[model samples]
Target: MNPAPSHVASRRDKLLILLTVCLAAVLLPLALSGGAVATPAIGRDLGGSPASLTWVTNAYMLSFGSLLMAAGALADQFGRKRLFVIGLGGFIVSSFAISLAPSVFWLDILRAIQGIVSAASLAAGSAALAQEFDGHARTRAFSMLGTSFGIGLAFGPLMAGTLIEYFGWRSLFITTGAIAAVAFMFGVPRMRESRDPNAAGLDYPGTVTFSATLVLFTTAIIQAPESGWGSPLIVGLLAASVVTLVAFIMVETRARRPMLDLSLFKYVRFIGVQILPLGTCYSYILLVVMLPLRLIGAEGMSEMDSGLLMIALSAPMLVVPIAVASLTRWASPGVLSGLGFLIAAAGLYWLSLVDFSASKTALLMPMLIIGIGTGMPWGLMDGLSVSVVPNDRAGMASGIFGTTRVAGEGTGLAIGTAILAALANTSLAHRVPEGGPELSARVAEAAQRLTNGDIAAAAAALPEVSRHALSLSYADAFVGLLHVLIVITLLSAFATFAFLSRTRTQGDGFERDEKGVEAVTRA
Candidate 1:
């Protein structure tokens, strides 16, 4: 066969990559946010204990967040294309398996596998795209990627809800898998293979310790309400999590080929980049999970109705990020991101004050504000994450940021859910006449069911507690959670403005190479 012109080949490759990435971005968050809305359906179809059902989300978040570091390193060591293909293949199979799952136990296990492979594909695919652009163009590409992610999150609930309403909950998984398959097919033929020969092998010890740390800590948080925070098992898990975390830091510092370069901590901008995800976790992600619970469980809305209402909360993400990206020409991303947070904080505070008894339209302004605020930082954070590091370390940078982002969601979900449950549980216990220690476990379980948007299940668990009472208690707890998110958003805004600098993106940038030689990387 005759060789094609270089420019023609390049254009073809870029187009194919764009298609695949957009699809991947959409499907990833579709699975996460969509699954959040689908929980009530899952619980109804497959009966399981409250703890087991929590694992339906936790299992995926746990594995996905924990293994990202290793996947990034593997991408750099092996070929990026090679790992990307493998990851997508695994994702397709696992998502399909999840669709046909017989019980929640199998679903949790499959979701875990799905998360693991997703880490691989996300790290490799993002790093591969980074290799193709530099300077403002790089920022634009990543901004596009971020926008695609927003679209997924924006539509995930409505799409999933609509699918579950008509087809079945299982169809959501099938849809995710089918979209992924197209990305695989288009990307495989046109994408060029690349790798960093300098990358050291995966740090197995670091992976194990880090994974163990998350497992122990998240388990402790999720199970604490039922078991009691002071219970021996919960205490032991917390202690072990602390120990493993310390061990992970030690292992990374001492290893010749650490999965994470501890040196990245020294850069203020890098630290700022990491903070952006955590900020979004509370301000945005928490809302995506909990709002549905309130709408469906407390307000007695159908899946389709709640999903439609959610468009107000998530729709700003679709446009605001792109606007912020363009606005960066006039303002530093730091200033824009911080401003966004303040806007979001304003919305969150308003949302807290708004009476749930009012029409749903009253909810729109605050949700839109919150989405716009978070979107500003969201657009730029993706580019900044990799831009702060050398191109050679793109996989590792993506991996580290990916880990922080996903792990934040995992921990945030656990913390947010636990807090909401605890508050509601206490409210329920108080409502119970002469309720004592014997009533605590059932009340806690009922509270969890309430937060999961299973008000009927919650009422069933606490037969003595009126369904109306349970709904009121949950609404109060959710509103309180919103107040907490507002404060976090404000802090995030201040930190963003204070810590991030234009130097990382526009000024002369340098990083020490493997041999201690400082080299100027692309701005």
Candidate 2:
């Protein structure tokens, strides 16, 4: 075949790469937000039980988390471009199947498949650019990648809400599938094939063992609230998880090409740099997801209004990367991560102070402050993470780093949700009481109403005094969620400071080679 015009080919190739990268990292969140809004509609259409609706989310998470480690190794063995195309094909097919799902059970299964496929694309995209470029160019490339990540995160919810408001839930599946197909077609031909020729054979046992460990651990954590920590199911799962995780570590250490190089944590700088990104996800979920619910249900605000109010959190994230990238020239990642945690913690503390009657405008200041705080860490973590690791390990490091962030987010949500649920139940139940049979029945009914998101029903069922008390209790719930956010942020700050600090002496012997950035270590 005749070689294409150089400029035209290059432009086409770049477009394809950018499209695939954004789709891989951002598509799931966009689909998730849209799907979340459509849970009611999906349940009604499929005749699904209330319990089954949660699967629309859980299934995706399970698969995404399940395949993350394997995807990184696959990208290194199979060509990055080749594996990415395969994953894209799988994603599109699964999405189409989900759109045509006959029932909720089928939809959940397909969503899980979609998650597994998406993780491959995500890992490939992160690794591809670093392998494709040299030294400083790679750093610039990662900045662009980080920017795409922020843009996708910000855009998904807004887009999802608009789509769900107009088209319906299944449209999410259709739209995502269409985008994946187009990107796949455009991406496959022009993209360069980049993979580590020196990489060892795939470590199948390590992949299976690690995946099982994560599954069992997450299941145990998620189930403990409902089943009781002492329940046979919870205790058995937890114990099995510990054994499997230990086995995974041992297995990876001995495997031909370990899915994850546990040795990365040997570098104190690398370990410290990751804590910020790892913990940032937790802050992201609480501020964006939980805060919105609190605003609408507890504070008097419409869903749209709450969404608008919450956009401030993301707005700063968009700009922070530029700020953080620039700051790194002068300061180290440790300085950046430590400062970021402090700012985020301050924002959380302010958030905890907002009461039920607080004004929406009053909430904006703290949100903006937190956003500014978050921007540095968000940007700094990505740049520093790739910078501190060796070229060959970039793919592995990115995979593990991203997984840690996701795990932190999942755990944070579970912890925050559990706290809010407990406080809401206890405070409301006490306010409603075991009194006269008729009064007691009415109060119990109101408590159920509050739990179910029917604030109006709860208000109407309670006596005037009890109504005021329940309102106060809801305020207490918001306070509790905020406190949870505060505690996490504080712990994150300390982790960043104590574990992240380094002297300039240790940073002297470092330089980036043609393949990628140089490794930095701590004193």
Candidate 3:
């Protein structure tokens, strides 16, 4: 054991961490900007009604959210390093398949495959951090991981927009595939086995039931506007969703190794900790994704211009890592989360009253303000969620937290769409009076066209007066979305206040050293 080759030893110790960060970074652009840029191209080549393009993103999200918990459990049972490598490989293959897809159906299949692989990578990345680092190294390791998430998120839109403009939308997948392939190769050899040999096996039955429940619920929400909430499909889907979800709960309670631990919620703080991620992540996706479309499609701005405007959304989070790391020391997590929510709500309220006809400058101010508010609590919420759980259950705690975040994001998108759809319908209907039956019918058709994602057709088919009126309706609908956002933010604030428990600023009695470094002691 004289001198273990210094370079090899150092490389072995750090290879897993480096690969994990790279794996996590690949997920962001795929999840964030791929759909926004690909929608038009996918719809055109595939020949589905323009409205079907929404499914491009919906398909990925549905599978991703549904399988997240099971994937987490799998990573903990098997080895994270092993699973991460496999996941990266699958993602690369699926991405290439999607790039070559001849139809929307094939593309959708590839997208679902991509979702499953991406979910596994995300789950394994968390456990890999725990396995690779100890003491203060773990703290710094996690911070680096968070930094990866932030940078990947910020870079996504810009990268996607440039690729789409210069080459084509498929470049999005090709690029992600290449990066993920590199990560897998670098990760396989040096990555050590870290899974607990004594850990319980996978819960297959619970996984199936829970996955079904999520798929059903998400499908109902997404189809409600299109199929009518009162339709049998919608009603049956919701009913089935509830029954399956309850069954999942029962199965988890009895499973030897449950994907989600039912007992974790008993800690009041555990429940409260879920709110911050839910609110912030939900608003972040809804606003950032929707704003680009609104600015480019509706406001007549170029894609580059719209992308530039949206980049400001990440500005608040840019300086937030240190602030979040420090804020937990000054007050309880509950108070900090509550303050963050209140600030977010205020920003949303300002957004709700936006003068749509005014300059874009007015809009950027609120967006930046909201970004600031949203960024403040990301880390503390994460800290609190994991802080309440035992060390052995770290993987489980992360699973539950990720599930809630996904659920919240799905719910937000559905709610935003429903509110906007209703406003658009009502506004259009009111302006075109039924007294002029023919004109009224034409106006209604135009409104329907707009909802179906056929903007050009809608404008061409409408009368001059009705064209002006429909624009007003679109404006009104955007306002409605802002109001809904404000209400949700306030609700999140109240929930954080009510549920999050007070914790000592130093976090679980782990004091900082004389140099002011807080060691990552076991929870």
For every model shown, what is its TM-score relative to the native structure? 0.91, 0.83, 0.88
Question: Residue 8 of candidate 2: its Cα lDDT?
Answer: 76
- Residue by residue across 377-432, what tens digits does model 1's lDDT show? 88778777876665666545766787898998999899988888888887787878
lDDT of 3: 0.69
Clashing pairs in model 3?
none
Give the alpha-carbon lDDT of every model. 0.82, 0.67, 0.69
Query: Which candidate should be chosen as best, given lDDT against the real structure?
Result: 1
Residue 340 C-alpha lDDT in model 3: 78
Residue 478 of model 3: what lDDT?
79
lDDT of 3 by residue, 1-523 (tens): 6566986787575866565555565465445555664565455456553234555666676677777777777787888877877777788898888778888777777887888888888777777777777898788777777777776666666776677667777777888888777776676566666786776767888878888887787777766655667889999999999999899999989877677888877656667778787788555667766665566555656555666677777656667646766766667777777777788778777877887557877777777777777876775766666776555555577778888876666556555655566666677777754657566555555544454344555576565545556667777877777787777788888888776645543235333452222222212
**Per-model root-mean-square deviation over C-alphas:** 3.6, 5.0, 5.3
Off by over 4 Å in 2: 1-4, 32-55, 99-106, 131-137, 192-195, 295-306, 356-359, 386-395, 434-474, 503-523
In candidate 2 the C-alpha lDDT for residue 322 amounts to 85
Better of 2 and 3 by lDDT: 3
